[model samples]
Target: MKIKLRHLAGKVFLSLILISGLSTPISAQNLISNGDFETWEGISTDTGLDKGIPAGWTSQTGDGNLTLYRTGTPHKGNYSVFARNTSGNVSRMFTPTLQPLSAGKMYKLTFYTRGKGTLANITLTENGEKLNGAVATSPSDKNIFASPSMLNKEYNNGKEWEKQEYTFTIQTDGIYKLIFWPKSTAGTDGETSDYFLLDDIELVEFVDETICTLSEIIVKGSTLKEFDPGILTYNITLAKGAAIPKVTATPADTKASVKITAATKIDGTEPERTTTINVTAADGISTREYKIIFEESNEILREGFASEDRPEKFTYPNKTNWIIDANAAQNNGVFFGNNSIRPKGSDFTDDYFTIDNCTSAGILSFYLKNRGDNANAILTVSYQKTSDSNNWIELKTIPDSEIGTSYEKISLPINSGEPVNIKFHIQKTAGLIGYNIDDISLTPFIATKQENEKTGKDIVFANGNTIHLQTSIPTNYTLYNINGQICTTGNVSGEYTLSVDTAGMYIISLQNANGKSVHKIIIP
Candidate 1:
């Protein structure tokens, strides 16, 4: 009994430990700002306030007083510290007798003051050096804070609270004293000191919890409309949190889609975290989706591709590829010659044609049909996955010896995502230079085992001439075989596995005489 009790206790302790390890919660960090004056009591040089002045604030000896105003409610209120000069020497200095400030972060300074003072200047100094470049509103009024050289303006009157806002972006990160000095050398004349009413002095950091962030998106479901004879567009929104999150996306299947991904950071923050995914179909249709994630390093956007025109011809620093003549000319030339490259092209063609549905993955098929008497043509095709067009690698070079008789088919396999641009040239290797290109197609090949669903009965076809019918039929429909022959037909509009004993190419057409129309399918 004693041994059993001990064993049970040990098992219970081990279980508790395992549960604690598995249930660890994610750590949370403080989003609110530090260096705020809510907790300043004891006075010190490092502290941002001084109690001797007014609420730990001290203004220069004068008839005017710097007021501390609070906006909004108690715990969630905004405080503004201002200096108002009623009548005295135009010089003013109000220093916080407690709590130091943290540099590098941005701080908002709001204040309002109006007086007959000739000149006014609010100098924010740490130790003895001025932190920010001075900004003077009333320059002519020597009794007010002097504006900076760039902002050469003077205050008009010393009454009424004139609103003004200032943002201080600290360069160096550290703790330092914050002092507000408003001076007017206007001297001790009968003129009263210019009024400088201040308010709403609070320091807080911005938290990015409301910025837009992209979670998950489907391009097919979000298409807006069909234009350009069926050019569909899809625009999907993302989850924009306080700070927009950056994004990087990979398509599940490249054969089904062609897309480009990009991201932008939230406003007033480094390293934009919002991403935009652009998708363009083979029919020259395009759409975009945005995704948001944390920040990271990436290339800055210099320019956007022109989608209106097909890019068949490309030049260096220019990422355009041409598969056929576009009749478009480059700088100071009409013919295609390689020069001026992103990687700096030299002695290259100036004219080129861009292939529609071109991709950098798998294999791309190029059909070059012999039109002219050119037996062996010299054509050079270069491709790269980078913006620098010069970085492109030569894919295929058809010398005078490799051109075969009759129509020839060329296949080039590529693995790239950077160089979306490609350049091509057809030259006389030995004999001729004319060849017509037709049926240009880009096919992305994927090699992966597809798992079969529901294992039970098995049906096999001896001949390779298997007819796979994929249709969207509504009700009862008839499926006809080759030579106007009707073998087996069904009404279902789903995956129908049929067995055909014959070994030949068959054309299967589905027609509902009383319904919409006829659908055709070819089996080889």
Candidate 2:
């Protein structure tokens, strides 16, 4: 009998084992002797029954045409068993008589194999009677144990060793033999020179007592933004000056125990506090951990496009550009909420969102995904201060080599604390499909009082195409054009003047002992 353990909501369901009244001990050793094929006692020949077979192993070839040898190429250790079929008949290798297994005890068989021939099936038999209901598992693919009499599991590892495992329980107390068929039974009537490499075979008693996952975690002071057993880490925002919440974790198994390391205090000194929950299963060997991060939420703006036709804080200067796409999946777009935004037309357009009175530097992050058929469509992200008359500073361009078909998180560093406007410009070149954007967020940098008081008073103005600055102390000044191109830079004290050859809006930045300050001026 094969007992398969299925999981739901991080809880392992052992109903099959409980209903059958079958349990195995936790400690057991490998029952297959000389299973590694490392002990060969005879010389290898072209064909024979007593030829170079590994100790405790035998083979069956219909007309005695299969050749066996010990090879130095092994997945591990020093040697592995290699079998070659010279005739059209199927060949198989057999294990020695296994130690007697209990009637209701579960056993697990595992081995590493690699080769070219079609490894057809594996079977366990006692006195020519096949054992039923064995389950085979492989990491390369899903479980393919369909028949009870024979396990038709084949892995085409092709020169690379792959591990395979099987689990089953015997209905009667008896000694058994395990067989490995190297060639398919039905086909290959005229096939020859087919080969198989086998190594690292093991059989042990299996006990399923390693389920220590939590079903649910609760916080007393605030609600979780989302909860999923598979997601172990979560970020929660607490109101400023609010006390840290009490946390409780519930294990999936009743026999499992949980320990919580709660945060003792929230004094607003640190930006965040981390709490951890550890769960230990009944066996005391299996464990899992979940973490909660409590942070003072200082979000500047967050847009998920839940219901708005367009983002509320966003302004579409082109007026008829992007629209809320409810069916993001149909268009191969990725979204976190109910919807995302995609270009309504395949034309070059610019759109922007503004955040006012931004007093600290921040990180701007969003999700962007390109259409699979997108061709030469470029999306550029840029930012500029609303009060300054300067061109947008380019942050990133999507659809580059780094972007994939699925939504990828794009994070950019915003170095300024000034009130700013962020722009997303899409230049659709040839293809009608463009990029999709969703889950836009901005988080300001936490600053100390000393860092926040860096800006000092300075007189800066522009007359015609010349910029003038009067500083109280020696300072370094840089003048830039509307396109963010540097016009001039120098160190000056008292009165300073810089004459430029262009006629447009400019920005002048001054840095001194007090710190850095930026000013905007127009030269018309």
Model 2 / residue 184 / CA error / Å = 5.4
Q: List clashing residue pairs in candidate 2.
A: none
Best by lDDT: 2
Best by TM-score: 2
Poorly placed runs, candidate 1 (over 4 Å): 1-52, 60-90, 96-103, 114-119, 128-162, 184-195, 207-524
* Ten-residue stretch with the least lDDT total in model 1: 12-21
Per residue, candidate 1 scores C-alpha lDDT tens digits across 87-172 of: 33333444443234454444444434444332234433333332222222322211222124212235554435454544344444
lDDT of 2 by residue, 1-524 (tens): 22233444443322222112122345567788788988887764543322487888877674425567776778899988776654534566777687877777777677877765445456555534422222221211122222332334444566688776656665567776676665532222322222367788887887656668888776762223366778898865543344566788788877789999886555443323878889988788778888887765445555555454555457776655667776647232222235677776545434434434344445666888776654556788888876774767787776534567787776565665576778777766442656777777665543332332354456776667777677779999866555545677899998888887778766665678765555556678
RMSD in angstroms, candidate 2? Answer: 17.2
